[model samples]
Target: MGELKLMKGNEAVAEAAIRVGTDAYFGYPITPQSEIIEYLMAEKPHERTGMVVLQAESEVAAINMVYGAAGAGKKVMTSSSSPGISLKQEGISYMAGAELPCVLVNVVRGGPGLGTIQPSQADYFQSVKGGGHGDYKMIVLAPASVQEMYDFVETSYDLAFQYRTPVLILTDGVIGQMMEKVEVSEQKPRWTDEEIAKNTPWATFGKKKDRERNIITSLDLDSARMEQHNHHLMRKYEEIKEKEVRFEKINCEDADYLLVAYGSSARISQKAIDLCAEKGIKVGLLRPITLFPFPEKEINEMADKVKGILSVEMNAGQMVEDILLAVKGKVPVEHFGRMGGIIHSPQEVVEALEQKIIGG
Candidate 1:
């Protein structure tokens, strides 16, 4: 359907950004994700498609730049690792409250601090449960492979502008750095001023002589108005939960045991399922593609079919709690993980399932 290339996950993200008719990108370099910026700079999308790629002074500055550009109704984005993402939280909250649409890619590394440049899924709680201080949620997409890392950029932007909210492409160091064959879409021209004006009537772009000027701000000193705004946000979230929940089911039809995971964990669990099959164990995998609008309903359904659910993650049992609530105690929901940037193997996952869910 598109041009194919062997590219690293981070490079796919950068290339996809250019192809998606993106107006601008502002980001700072962090390991595991630095390739995104590097590829963009080397490619010089401005020369090819009038795309602007600027390395910001800091992650905070980059996110604010995205806010400013997105306000102008331009397709904009930024990428960073975990700690850098933390620095951008306030801006992310501002973007969310203002209802500005933009794509943010977080190639997760380790920890509460600078944990490690190696892969880790420790940011699950931060990503899905509102990392910034507010009653705000980003549409979080957990991409498992380099192809998904490439493909989700366009999907994130589509969701962002459709809902007029920020969207996140959340992956980890392994996916960001891993190389794979990806089919990239052909580059499209950037949106013209007239096109932007027509498509995004709410955008704070140059107000036409006939139309009323758009006012964009998240600040409301009036408690009543703020509460009303919160209500509106909640309504939007409910609609998204109904409409945008995405997931993948592997060998779930007749599985006796299930593995619930996402991102790299999901990929590992797929192999673990094969290992389980070889052992005459019927293990299935339920991968949540959209972490925010999680596939809770589907998981609840799976609970009725499977004997137990093993929440495989790279954190300290973060997503396990969500699975627990989804199952509603209908069956066993246990967690297996390795923190501090240590990746777990398929054998390890199989062992955890045998001991924790079945043997326990």
Candidate 2:
């Protein structure tokens, strides 16, 4: 077993990046997630592991830096909260379009515009569905625990490089700020230049005499070529959907009702499940680990078994639409949320389940 240490979720994420040999981190400071860059700056990963850590002038610049670094075939990453993430949407879209590999962490907070530093899942649509303008998809991983926060960093890098696309770690402030015991993996050495060249031939490194110069751009002037590119992207998404769906089912063996949630909401919903159990209600929890390649198969199968499903979140019902699509109206699925940075307690979630799903 790896060494266990008590750490905050944000700290765990930063340390995990170091353990995974992330080549660079370019991010702007934002509340609820600033710990990521702060830890990197304090730890001086450049001195420890030769990893570059830079605080860019703005979120826009930070993401563009990530795009540039990732284009050079490096394992790059960045972190931000809701509003800051919004500012990086254009750069994120560019990364997705160019099929650059990088990891983005959204320690989500309340928002439409500068909402709150408190936790919220309001960015579900923006994170899972295309955030910026274009027909592109990012691999989204929602970590429910501090342990997952540590573990998913490595997973995100692997998936990003495997698919040649950006991967998002969708978490919230509650998890980011909370402290928990985490077992971290062994430190990995950074990829050598030879390894990078061998693994990422498409990367825009200095062109050698043997091969043509690599071009990383989303632009396609020819209409027919653009259509072809779109088709290619769709095929990639299909492959990701087919192979990468991940979710966790808890107490679902003979459950009568189900709670659908992810990240911090999933943690709270687990408590809600226990609360419902005390009242003789067998409530199961289906927590999606991968939001983009959603666990639709598991959700659909559970929808057939459970009498009702309660989609719990910290927003005004965003992921509920995905649940609805999965269930296909086979069973009743209702959304229960507390918006504007408000977090719902376990008791409140139980009440909502009874009022919105079970009784009503």
Residue 31 accuracy (lDDT) in model 1:
89
Give the CA lDDT, 0 to 100, for residue 23 in model 1: 97
Q: Across residues 274-344, which tens digit of lDDT does each residue of candidate 1 receive?
A: 99999899988999999999899999999999999999999999999999989999998999999999999
Candidate 1 runs further than 4 Å off:
none
lDDT of each: 0.94, 0.95
Q: Which candidate comes out best when scored by lDDT?
A: 2
The 10-residue segment of model 1 with minimum total lDDT is: 199-208
Give per-model TM-scores: 0.99, 0.99
Instruction: Report the number of clashing residue pairs per model.
Output: 0, 0
For candidate 1, give the lDDT: 0.94
Ten residues in sequence with the least summed lDDT for candidate 2: 109-118
lDDT of 2 by residue, 125-238 (tens): 999899999999999999999999999999999999999999999999999999999999999999999999998999989999999999999999999999999999999999
Model 2, position 295, has a per-residue lDDT of 90
